[model samples]
Target chain A: MSRQASRLDAKKVNSEFLTLTYGALVTQMLRDFENAEDVNKQLERIGYNMGMRLIEDFLARTSAPRCLEMRETADRIQQAFRIYLNIQPTISNWSPASDEFSLVFDSNPLTEFVELPPDLTNLRYSAILSGCIRGALEMVQLEVQCWFVQDQLKGDNVTELRVKFVRRLEEVIPAGED
Target chain B: MSTYYFVIVGQNDNPIYEKEFSTVNKELRKEDHRHLTQFIAHAALDLVDEHKWKTANMQLKSIDRFNQWFVSAFITASQIRFIIVHDNKNDEGIKNFFNEMYDTYIKNSMNAFYRINTPIKSPMFEKKSEIFGRKYLLS
Candidate 1:
């Protein structure tokens, strides 16, 4: 699915609009939350909510089949990000157990001109993406932990996120016994 | 033409949101039918659970029938279940209604203040849902 060309044409939007709106949102969140951690949590929560909805759009658009393995899930995410965001991240550092993997993004549009202030250096500017991936995967019953291990804003050449599969959820049948 | 009851069930089997509307052509009822509609919708949940594992698809169409009422369901991958009960059976229209409702639910979920399993109190959500019901299910 990752190799196939996207059927939907990319909708063009003014980059300025995106940058300005996102920047304002972040600024307002920082102001309202006061604490950087709280801002991060808020951002993640927003992303999680968005992800819960986005997966539907993705499935409806792509009609991609369910992923049976973690590796396939990684590919699906890569394809989804590429098609939607137009940024392809390198999937690497797969654990022997195949329960964890890292996505290294050479360029992240979300952080194009985002420069974290020295006081808020701890802020993960793109943490929302991690939260989105986590929330979307969780909906598919793949319980996983997603976090940014390396961020370009933090002076790293590549922004990387590590996803660790916690466990697979068995569908709890409410009335299994006849 | 018949009355329609919509219910959204959370992953924990809690009622997250619900609404009742009759066909646009029919006169709206003044009687307090909320409790009865809720009861029928709640009873259908048990049937939804029993049938959920039987099929991989999300749309559990016409799962149960009580008198003239028929239940149709659409379960999101996140386990948020959108169920609709009505007298007339129009499978395609019900599917479209659920799809639109899913979109609205997603938009509601995107709100930073909103949390899972909580009743949706957003006026915007309520308004959109009403519009969808009128446009698709009612008409």
Candidate 2:
């Protein structure tokens, strides 16, 4: 192979390597702090910052960028939740009976092969997910409250995460006239 | 002898599996971690939440000097958290040990026998532990 081509290939490989390396590093940090709630808070803060950069990357990588509308962006986010994370998020009706929109987890990869210790039965372990989704959405400037409504470990067999959007992120939005 | 505590936290910061191990030379009961274990869990939670906004994946070695212990965290996709804690003296070995262990853990989690937020009592854990000790500590 030509030297230039070799260099280019190396660059491509190097970039790919960096991506996995970064992913593993983040997963490892979350793992280390998994035992400490305070550290987990720090981890989430780290995640929020990451979501900001990641959103930029997500936009740069795709060929067709802009969503047709606000609802289209929301749908794309839902699709990304599945394609990227392997977890399909269900959108539920939020009416008088329902408090907020929820992203239900039919199969949670994070919780697989996990059993809660007896003491934590009352306290939900999935708070990290809520915090994460909230942090990610917040990066896009969406104000949301995400929490675990049901945990499979608690015998519900279905994990439900609810996201209540408080308001659109107007501050980050572009300005024209209002 | 040193002691190590490891856990896998989901996107929600919930523990999927937790295991406590003291130096193989020392015999310690799992029940001993009742209090310290919770303390460790809380610390990890704090670290995860604190880094919720950072774009780069991090290795926060020795976040606390008082304990002479270091924490290594891995956060993926703004989802999934994996944490391992150990002493500073053997930090190098611990890193490689965890990298290998993670491969096993991921494979183990994929098995039908596995479920989230549960104790990691699979015989494979012991088998892997023994192998890890032999490969790293024995030499």
Candidate 3:
């Protein structure tokens, strides 16, 4: 596929449509759930569902090759994010085993002009992104645990997410039965 | 060339859609194959639940075998399950078929009126799946 066709056209969607719709959705969830923690979990669950399906579209559009290493997976995620969302996040802090890493976003479009109430300090405003990553990775047979370690909305300079590779899922075959 | 049965099960374990087809290379009487295929697909569900948590990959190839019947499965993150039963054993072809079905499922889900885990009644989805089966498996 041509690179131009793979990239999501920003012209097709109005910027205000994304900003307003996402902002309103979050606000509605916060109201319906009536608890910051519940709202955060709900957002993550919604993102998880969306991510499950979105990965198929991502793969079809990018035609990306399967990553042979965790580092490559991180790079693929970065490329996917850039092409789909038009934002780039720096990936760093790889563990010695190369099973864990962090993604630091300089600017998060989801939280533009958003402020968390003092009572909702415990809520992870960008938990949905983490959920998306987790769901997408799981689909590719990589079981991972992803959570936000820092958020710009919470006075952090950058939004940081820590992803820990749990284990590779192995296909089970009946032993001595086939 | 053999008969094939395809089933889409909801997260709640309810069947949402099903179809049966035979390979073009060999003709099998549809009436003769109908009940056996349904039984095979239904019997494979228990094995699917047994093996689902053991792996994270969507394509669960050849989860169960009963006599000559073989079953493979593809699971979505929302917990939807795509199960296939066939007399011929070809894991690679089944995986590719499931991937196409997954794409169709995603498109169907995008409809504003469609709800997750509900029986898929869209004629568009049905037609696409039929075409995929004819192209990839029947021929």
**CA shift of A78, model 3, Å:** 0.4
- Measured with C-alpha atoms, the lDDT of residue B62 in candidate 2 is 37
C-alpha displacement of A144 in model 2, angstroms?
1.4
Q: Which candidate is the best by lDDT?
A: 1
Better of 1 and 3 by lDDT: 1
For candidate 1, the docking band is incorrect
Tens-place lDDT digits, model 1, residues A87-154: 89999999999999999999987776565656788787777898899888878888889999999878
lDDT of 1 by residue, B1-139 (tens): 5678898999989989988878543345556566877888898888888888899988888899888788899898898999998888788888888989998887666543356689988777889889988888877
User: DockQ numbers for every candidate?
Assistant: 0.01, 0.03, 0.01
Docking class of 2: incorrect
Model 2: per-residue lDDT, tens digit, B3-64?
Answer: 66667677566676666556644444444544665466557667665765554644443333
The C-alpha TM-scores of every prediction are 0.52, 0.41, 0.52
Ranking by DockQ: 2, 1, 3
Per-model lDDT: 0.83, 0.57, 0.81
From the highest lDDT down, the ranking of the candidates is 1, 3, 2
lDDT of 1 at B74: 89
lDDT per residue as tens, model 3, B1-139: 6778899999777889998777643343435766787888888888888888899788888899888888899888888889998888777778888999999888676543346788887777889888988877776
Best by DockQ: 2
